[model samples]
Target: MSSSLRNRLAAVVMAVAAGLLGCTPASEPGASSEPAKPHRVLNTTAQPEDTIRVRGDHTERLQAFLRLRYGDKAALDAPWKDAWEDTEVEALRPVTRRVCARDTATADGQEQTLLAVCQTLDDAATVEPGRVDLYVLRVGTDEEKTNRGGFFAQLPADDPLLVMAQRLQGQYGRHGSPGTVQIAQLGPQRRAFQISHEEHRRGHRRVWRSYIAEHNHRLRDVARYRDHLDNLALHGCDGNPADCGEGVFAVDFNTTVGDSNAVEGYWPLTVRASGHDCTGPATAFYHLIFDARQRAYPVPDDLQRDGCADS
Candidate 1:
């Protein structure tokens, strides 16, 4: 072999050796080559993650769970901010503590889900791995189903926790929150959702109770704007005679990461409101910032403001 070729081969072998050695931390003091992984890591091989491709809403809710802080962890402190609509979320685990599956009946038919009780653990974990519970939700598809209506919930008798997660996911994801109560009258919350029954299902009533315990989160923001700019005066017909009503706030559904097939997917929520008094225009946009260890979806109070100057 030529000396030049031998030198090139030696360089390639050295590069491979360096990469292999860098897989773990160095014995000497220097930054480790390992990258920072986010909290809510999913799909462990020791205890495999669920394979169920749940209804769109459930998937979205799961994503909402993934983004929030798990506690006062310095590492996981991330909040939603301005004009980040195209922000891409890593497909991190939804902090699932426990997952249970069950069946429920409706006028239209029956539906099933793996009621995963989720929590935020550091990339390492907050609790002992043995202490954490486990269940696998292996989902089935249309082609595999021999019968119609897909999969139906067939959990162990009286496993109320699974039942409850099924109920809440169905109710909230189905009807949404209280201010905008969903009428039970709406059939199947719109359209068809099917599940497979071939898999043996189990329920842990404890999981449902835990899910409910952390589910009640509220977001509130107090913004009082007074613009005496001739037209933008507070409740004043003097500055701008033709005054519109109070600024309108509406919830905007984030389509990204939501189930592409379903219209409304999950609750990584955003609030949009536009206000003006003729001098110009102002808007407040809010998205629930997930803190560590949140269970239920919280309407966000943190509002990012956008305004057009009168000057």
Candidate 2:
């Protein structure tokens, strides 16, 4: 082979060897030989946790708790303030603040208190027309601990009950409404949290969704259903409000915790709804019997369907 051809062949062989060994060609003077680091895409999703910081002061500890619970998605600045404090934080106001306690015996037979703190996020601008976020913290007394407390369970913004309610809202083509969170005593040592979303648009429409959840090590959804719906627009009141007449269709639910059977733990929920639609007046009764296999009260198809006829 010719000298020039042999030299080109040798260069090609060296390049192939370098490519096989994952070696890059030398760069110009002062240029970096190190490959550029990949840009890291951070996971901003909030992770619900059952443990939090319990050492700092009330405010500091709350701040730490929010940070730990929300991670990168936590807005620690303006418009988002802690509603747990006694006084209002600037424009933000406390919508719901519930504290429930239960007595239980520890491993050593010492009586311990289980405290549940439930609060809802408040927005100053849209105070009464938006779906508010809820935060729940289950704290236990620990005399030996420095802070004298330890969190046992927590239900953050990503709670299943809240997600289900939001999904219902989406299905109804409704947005921006107010909701409430309350603690319910189901039995002796059993406590459950109930979340209710209510929306009323004067003569146009009205809707309500409710959910009950209990925490046993982790949060479990017990009952969820659309409690009420009153839509006047579906019949003939869409164009003219005054011509609505008596052509309104509405559904109202009356729920009872336990039945006449007097069952013990996790009492059954019975829901009864009565209303009149375009067709005629109707009444529906549903016994939210707990199924041990599914661990959730399955809502009936008729109950889940919209109670209004097509316009």
Candidate 3:
């Protein structure tokens, strides 16, 4: 077997073992306030004494990328220390998914490899749980140039994707439940990314925001909707306890994205809900059409809100 394959298999095994052993870091009472002592950080660059060097492998590159990004944060030291490079904590490690790879002709008409990668940082504790980041790597023949330009370059401040991410971060506080990143193919040559944020209050709620890829590697907001909502509090059961079961109302919608046959330069989102309420079992379907001028898929006003109202 190839060395790369073996390394990947070993990483999978280690992640599984770590999960089984429950080595995830816990939020200490005072760990966030105090700065942790300096420790050896993973070295991605080639050095005389370094044992392993990160080259083109995405997994290795992601590990090195995260260590360089968050290794120095004093607040994250405790949980970061237990991550893959330092110790064993699956939740604290970086999770990566390859979006796509394409060979395109450059200005000089030479074929260049472009790769899109999505990485989620599940800090477990300290702060920013399930924070996701996207990267576009331009692979070249020169290792030094590729590493310097692709791995270390930061996303521009005005980038649409970064802006949307920041908005979500502000909407959901640091201690909010971990969010998830997903990729969907809208058409043969078109693709989009969906960011889902879940929160729990008296009830549970999940919202999905979709962005479509455009020219110059930018993303445009396409759709936003609530896919899950549940209210655990019983209502409309004042007289008798038997009706309490029917008083509970919860809604879950399954969303699917596909190429839009009706609209040009857009995609269609289908939301199907199979839920129950005091009224009885309820089912509904929403075919959200994209508004080109508005550049968004308008969801029903009722579905846009969270939680079930007491009737």
On lDDT, who's better, 2 or 3?
2
| Candidate topping lDDT | 2
Candidate 3 Cα errors over 4 Å, as ranges? 1-130, 140-177, 204-216, 233-247, 260-265, 277-281, 305-311
Report model 1's TM-score to 2 decimal places: 0.20
Residues 236-293 of candidate 1 have per-residue lDDT tens digits of 3333233444432221122111222322212233444444422335355544332324
* TM-score for each predicted model, relative to the true structure: 0.20, 0.48, 0.48
Q: Candidate 1: RMSD over Cα atoms?
A: 20.4
Tens digits of per-residue lDDT for model 3 on 1-311?
A: 34553575689888898899989646787567675533332222211111123464534443454444345431211232223232443122443222322222232232222322322334434344443333333333334323644422332211111111111121221342335455555544444555566654444334455453443444556666676655553343333323457556666678877655745445687888776643556587888886766666778865544325424
lDDT of 2 by residue, 1-311 (tens): 23543565689899999999999787788998786432211111233333342554434444555455433333333233233222333232433322322222232243322322323334324323433333434333332222423222231211111111111111111232245455665544455556566554544354455444444344566677776666664554443323356656666778877734423355677788787544566587888766666766677867754535222
lDDT-best of 1 and 3: 3
Off by over 4 Å in 2: 1-50, 56-136, 140-178, 198-206, 235-247, 259-264, 305-311
User: What lDDT, from 0 to 1, does candidate 2 have?
Assistant: 0.45
Sort the candidates on lDDT, descending order.
2, 3, 1
